[model samples]
Target chain A: MTAQPRIVEVRQKVLRRNDVLAGELRDRFREAGVYVVSLVSSPGSGKTAFLEKILTMMGRQARIAALVGDLATDNDAVRLARAGVPVRQIVTGTVCHLDAVMVQSALEGWKLAELDYLFIENVGNLVCPSSYDLGENLRVVLMSVTEGEDKPLKYPTIFNGADIAVVTKIDIAAAVEFDWNAARANIQAVRPEMEIFRVSARSGEGLTEWLASVESRRAAKNRPG
Target chain B: MHELSIALSILEGAAEEVERQGGGRVYAIHLKLGSLSGVAKDALIFSYKLASEGTPFEESRLVIDEVPVVVFCPECRAERRLSSIQQFCCAVCGTPTPDVVRGRELEIAGLEMDV
Candidate 1:
């Protein structure tokens, strides 16, 4: 008699474990009243620069701390710590993105309640970072003027997943001849009704509005539910 | 690429399924690959081979079912398959669709095994 092959139905999500952990982290963040924000962008999108500026601007008032992810170096961690806020580096080694477990582990020995705002700077990749949820209340995706206007269209998944979009390097937007209308149109096309913030880390323009918006949103999230 | 990590997760998931099935050797794994899942099919197949090494799945095959992106348009009140990833607007009314009804799947559909 011939041996028969068995077919077993699995129907399981591949990243379900990460999703569960991220849910737990979200609960923990909510209970502790610590608002978490994460940043995602392609490399050289001025994410670190903008984060540095934000930390410098709101660190004292918000009691903010940060955790930055990269493929190899602690360079971002080092640079962000210079703003005098507690910063940790999650070195992903060969991984292209940061998962919930990595974030939970990197936050070892730290009290989430003690920190009002915790920022997670994901590995600088627009594609992979969108797939993993790191339990952040606000997920901000960045695009620099130098990266072209159609970036949001090219990576719609990332844009669709983000709560807010930030346009960086606006100080040189005129010098680069960045098309404001085209950029806004493209972002709107991919994600209609998306809130976008334009800022320049060098001149610090638009930082106050961004900070105020973040503060208001965080307050909204902290409302008794 | 993150495909390797995804491949690892698939293997882990498949192994658990295999164990729950009262012990069997997995011959092939079936997966649903979606357009909006942000996973490359060819890259995932290649990574699966590398990740399966030295494990029971070393000789197993990965069979992926490619799923097309499907979005629902509230204006049109219809769900349509996306012809292009760049164009998310409804095929009927041309209104942009923010509701994705399908094509974000990244899951192990089933397993072919010998009991």
Candidate 2:
């Protein structure tokens, strides 16, 4: 008789290692009382511009640091450092998304407890970044007015994965004929009750409310039980 | 693409599982892939070939089961599977649902091996 092959049951999540590392990173962030926020979006969605605004505004109230990831170049890092905060660039080389290990390695010489807010700017991509969690307390997904309003519906995975959504380039919304109500409705349809913020980094229209909200959330997270 | 990284992870996991089984040659790896997992099946398959080269999984075949998006409907009080990812509402009651019951899976379910 011919030999029979065996079938073995091995139920294991493929990303288990990353998940475990992310859990450790989360615990570390919690212990240090550092509020980590990450930004994700498609290219040219003004993530860097918005982050620059946030760093400038919130830096006055807290000690902030930024780590930006890109396939190549430290352009974003240099630009963000102009805000006069500690900034580092994690050049991912060929990696499309940033994983927990990358974030952990990028934070090698830094002390988490010395900072209030740590911002991670993920490589600009809506699809791949949704699958990787970088151990951030707040994950912000952004879309610019220049992109389609149905962007949320098109990439619902990212929208669902994010804690908040930010609509960037609002100052040029009128000029671009961006449909404001449609965008809001699309976001609502995808995530039901997701918190959304509209801001113009150029004109600083909605910076106050956004900054105040971040401060309050950071404060609340650090509050004793 | 990120599929290469995913394929590499799969190879590592599969190798460990095979080794844990007290030595075997893997013939096929069965995977459960959900559309919401953000992985392109064709790309992953292509990348798997590159990732498995010169490894124990070099000759293994990837058998994928595509899982459709399923969500819990509060209005219907039941879980419904959607025909398409674009339809986020309950297939039965048609109410919008953010409570996903199933999908978003990326796991190796089983392996066919020669002992």
Candidate 3:
């Protein structure tokens, strides 16, 4: 004779642990007066280049640091360090995404209060990174001109997860005949009213507006509630 | 790729639940996965099997209920089911709204076990 299995209600979020950690991180950032931003996108979308540009430009006006994640190499950290801002590399080994635990551990020794802005560059992956929240004030998703306008349509989950969409490598938009309007339309189709920024890290096009917008956002985040 | 991690999380949640109930042999784990949760159902099921191997849940079954994305339609003044994630508009009114009311759920709803 075998006993029948009984159903037991256990309504719980699977990622509750991550969510709790992220909530703690958010409170920590708020107390430290640091505006945290995270970047996510597919590989070869110019995340490092754009981050490098932001760090170099923003370094002059405010205190900023970055934590870059990759599957194997610290190459991105080395590249970003040239911008003169504190950069840390999180080698995920075979992991494809950065979770809240990784961010919490990486910030173990850093003084969050000393920095005005903290950027987390997630591993170059659109799919996996969308699931984990890194406790960022803003999440930016990059899509290069070479990656096609349909990129957002193909990966709506990531686009929906992100707060803003950045079109990188606009300098070669003409060379690739990338339809800017179509890209914008596609992004809007997936995530309505999503703020979009067109920038070229190589040519420095559209950097001024983007930087100003980011600075204002940071200011707003630091404003007393 | 991240499905393996998600499977592990499910296992951890189930184990905690079993312990809370004074320990039991888990027969099945019920999960509610939303379309916009960014976790593929098939991949998670496959990963669950591998993650359960050699564990107490080795013979346990994973039951997933896939939930579709739903958005609040301002024009319709009601919640509407979205036909496709690619389009955020209401299925009936076609009003574009960013107010997502549902989906994005990765949760353990229940468990069947014998204590």
Candidate number achieving the greatest TM-score relative to the actual structure: 3
Docking class of 1: medium
Q: What is the lDDT of candidate 2?
A: 0.89
Q: Which regions of candidate 2 are displaced past 4 Å? A: none
Fraction of native Cα contacts reproduced by each candidate: 0.73, 0.72, 0.89
TM-score: model 2 vs. ground truth: 0.95
- Please give the C-alpha DockQ score of model 1: 0.73
Give the runs in model 1 whose Cα sits over 4 Å from its true position. none
Number of the top-ranking candidate, with lDDT as the measure: 3
Clashes of each: 0, 0, 0
**Candidate 3 residues A36-81, lDDT tens each?**
9999999999999999998998989899999999999899999999
For the predicted complex of model 2, DockQ is 0.71
Q: Given candidate 2, what's the lDDT at residue B95? A: 87
What C-alpha root-mean-square deviation, in Å, does candidate 2 show against the real structure?
1.6
Task: List DockQ for all candidates.
Answer: 0.73, 0.71, 0.87
lDDT of 2 by residue, B1-115 (tens): 6899999988889889988988878889999998788888999999999998898788989999998888888998998997557557877777887788778899999999977
Q: Candidate 1's residue-wise lDDT over A1-225, tens digit each?
A: 857888788899999999999999999998888999999999999999999999999977888889999999999999999999999999998888999999999999999899899999999998898779899999999999999999998898888788899999999999889998999888877776778999999999988999899999998977778
Which tens-of-lDDT digit does each residue in A1-225 have in candidate 2? 756777889889999899889999999999998999999999899999999988988777789999999999999999999999999999999888999999999999999999988999999999899888788999999999999899998998888778889999999999889999999988877776677899999999787887777778888888889
lDDT of each: 0.91, 0.89, 0.94
